[model samples]
Target: MPDTKPALSKVSVMQDLLKVVAPYRWRIAAAVVLLISAKISTVLVPLLLKRIIDALSQPQTLKALPIYLLAGYALLRFSSTLFNELRDLVFSRVTQRTVANYAQMTFEHLHLLGARFHAKRRMGGLLPDIDRGTAGIAFLLGVGLFTLVPTLIEIALVLGIITSRYQAWYAGFIMLTFLVYTGFTVVFTARRTIHQRRVNRLDSSAKSRLADSLINYDTVKYFTNETVEAQRFEEIMRHWTEAAVANQKALFTLHVGQSAIIACGVAAVMLQAGSDVMAGRMTVGDLVLINAYVLQVCLPLNALGFVYREARDAWVNAERLFDILHERPEMEESRGMPALSPGRGEVVFEHVSFSYEPSRPILRDVSFRIAPGATLAVVGGSGSGKSTLARLLLKLYAPAEGRILVDGQDIARVSATSVRSMIGVVPQDTVLFNDTIGYNIAYGRVGASQEETVGAAKAAHIHELITTLPGQYDTEVGERGVTLSGGERQRIAVARAVLKNPPILIFDEATSALDSASEHAIQQELNRLSHNRTVLMIAHRLSTVVDADEIIVLEQGRVIERGSHEELLGKHGAYARLWQLQQREDMDQRAAASRA
Candidate 1:
């Protein structure tokens, strides 16, 4: 959802803007010198009018008048053009560099932030904020600070010249009145523009979230939740529209106030100058200079409002983007991490208790151990902590209490990166990145050979499908592998695991959502894959894992039984009852097929 409130203001934003430009400060300093020099030439041109006016009123001296003024004016305009060009080139380079660096830093930090942070955040809140924030920084520093700052400095310079060369009281009067006019205009305009920016931020975020929902339209359709999701999206858009309309209304009021004040100030200044000339106190040149100078000074003052609008917007984004940059990652072991190497692949869960939230345990003092090369089949109902145990062993979530040792070293005492590198997991819903088949298969290692990738794909029975495609291994799988069937996606997951060749393997309901034909093909591949590694299989289809070396049956986060299928059946306990239930389900499926 869109954030309803503005996170920052332009006044607060410009204060820290220097940090974004700090790395390029030297270049900025050089550019500022050029910009200021160029600005002086433009500012001086109006004063030359006073000289031209005096020459005309004086005794006609060959009227060298027009020629001299034209030459001097042309020279000043040329120099202004040269220096301004240099300033533009320098500022463009610096601004682009700064934007690139900030965007890169934000993206890098997002990747390091781990899964939990992503889980809590909305895409609606993140992507647009970051994009806007980075673009704002470029505008604020490049134009607002560099371009607008010099414009204001030139105005003050003109005011200084007017007070010294003309009448001090008159110059003071002009400065005071003009300042009041522009100041009020800027303040009123800022309020409206700021509101509009906030509205746009909300609108952009809602649209992004809607796009994400559409990308997963299959899930919405399958669950018959299309109408529900469409209504939710409409609700967010309705609020966005209301905010936008209010902001536009405020902006219209601001423009009216600003235009009237500027027009009045110009008219008042010219009238005062004309009256002085008529009274014989001021020369004809004085009127011409005053008219031109007023327009020049008013340009930058008016632009102040535009700069303020962009500055406020840039800061709003900066706050959100920085929030991601400053976030701490999930608790990672900082010290005493032992080396991870191939060992027994033994998994020992000793009094392991864990909870995502305190006093709300997922696994309660659960304890179990499996030797190297042993197949451990975990069986339980939903939320019984079976998958939780597997995740703990893989170090996806650290156990709240007790320890899990692999190769006689606690998994917690080893670097998560290395520990996870040696383990392969096949999750229930197989997810594939948008990449070529070759790249996805070779993802387990950065420098895998084509031979290895193909070999792994062949073992998983997906090599045939890849070869049939025009590009073979080079074909791009569409987003989240949507171009592939459920069975095809699962086989790709198997291929990835085969490529990884980890000492430990986990299949968490890997084949539970497949047709019988796809299930049987994948089961054969899985059996071959578990040959020399420690395997943990969590499945709803009990018959598939009937030949597992050992089974640890859980009930409400507690392991209640452990043995082979035959041994458990002989005991006529939980495993026996489960086996009977699976047989009934198999018979039902067959009966349905026969009736059809």
Candidate 2:
């Protein structure tokens, strides 16, 4: 029942990373060259130091302070730093670009995904996953490449030099130490990874709870359940804290173990060097050189353990992101699919059946037709599949057992974009972006001019109301347009559909939130707008659909009655019952108003 897909393997994650980095291969190569230069300079610095020590130790060679050698030592040290800085500078663009590329790809893909996928996703947890995923890419590129690879190269160079110039025992001791240190790190870090994963999961859960609580702040306040929400959020955070502590304990163990191994290795190597010097088999300069090489190798080995651990964490984060990329979209848009041809808006559904799940069917054997420039109204109680019909027409979901046609063409044969472009919908629950009113209106048709947006607002009968506000069209609609009243949000939805001016229109309880006067005015505008366009009206108010060219009464996803409003009333079926009940309710409301 969980929405998340399985995490990708480390190999797959790396393969995806390489594909993104392939475009910057030349830059990466340049960075690698700089890396080698830096390491070479680094290795030569200690050699120069050994020479300085040998020269200083011998009475005959102490003259002139070995100025050239001292100068070379300083220059090599500076050159090492200089090359490392230059490598980072050259490769910085590649890391940043790769992050941006993946972020944009994920963002665009989220929009292309179906409503079903989005309905199941929690925005709170989803955002953190994306943030961590992109950050992981940056770490793997910057630290993993520079630290891991350079450390290995330096190790190889140090081992090679020590084996050629010193006793075989020195090189052998360091190699054995490296193997043990690496083996220890791998085993401990693997165990720590399990803890790290748990920490990440709990962290996401806590954030999800926080966001869910804040988003429903009004609901909590209404029910006086602030304490309940706090308790729930605290519970999740408590688990996160526990997991984080466990992860830290594992990290401490790994670090302490690594330090112990390196300390023993260094002590052993230094003891051997001292014995060799005392026995006359090596000079004081050889002792210093051997000491310098051992420390050099051990320091990076320590850092190598840390880098390897972080890389594993990075791999986990990247795997979660790549899993999202691997998810198959509910509907695939094939390449070179034909666009729906422009024509009179004639819509038809043939034996269409659909279900969100096999056990719960939403629509069944539904068939209907809307003639060009005519309106067909569908009436039903709650859960009768009236909205599903509109969803099917908009190509939001594919029909399970039948096909829908627009302008005599099967919609499945055309690109979804084309099908959607030809129709406009006003949903019952209108949720607007947290933006200026003009922006929300213009979203109906991207890049619409100010004049066009204002005109559409006027058509929806909300222009005067907007002008009364301080900011007018520029007024901010807060999150989900919560700043506005329900009727106001409905008007904006109607304005958006009006702005689109598509060949086909679907009004799913479009005027349900408006007052009677506003509803009557908007209803007239909607009728005018529906002229010369196919319209599917899904309504609960019997009064609004009385003038529909034809009416279909749906009960449990089946059309039980079909005819003109008057004809249905004459039949005294479900439609008649609904009309009579609404009439009585209207009369009672009027009587109550008079009494008041």
| Predicted structure with the largest lDDT when compared to the true one | 2
lDDT (tens digit, per residue) of candidate 2 on 120-233: 998888898899989988998999889999899999999999899988899888998999999999999999999988988887788888899899989999999999998988
Per-residue C-alpha lDDT of model 1 across residues 1-596, encoded as one tens digit per residue: 34333334334444445666687878988998998999899888887867877777785574454777878978888898899899989888888888898898888878767666777777766777788778877876787786578767887888888888777655665576567766876677567656766686777668676877888888998999988888888988888889888887886776666667767778888888899899998899888898888888777666765566556556554666655665777855676676676687988889988887786778887787778998999997888888887778777778788999888888787888778887898888988889988888888666899999999999999999999999899999988888889999999899999999999999999998999999999999999999989998998888888989998888878888888988988989988898899899899999999999
lDDT: worst 10-residue window of model 2: 1-10
The residue-level lDDT of candidate 2 at 568 comes to 98
Instruction: Report the error of model 2 at residue 206, Å.
Output: 1.2
What TM-score would every model get versus the actual structure? 0.89, 0.97
Local distance difference test, each candidate: 0.81, 0.90
Candidate 2 residue runs with Cα over 4 Å from true position:
1-8
Report the number of the highest-TM-score candidate.
Answer: 2
Model 1 scores worst on lDDT over the 10 consecutive residues at: 1-10
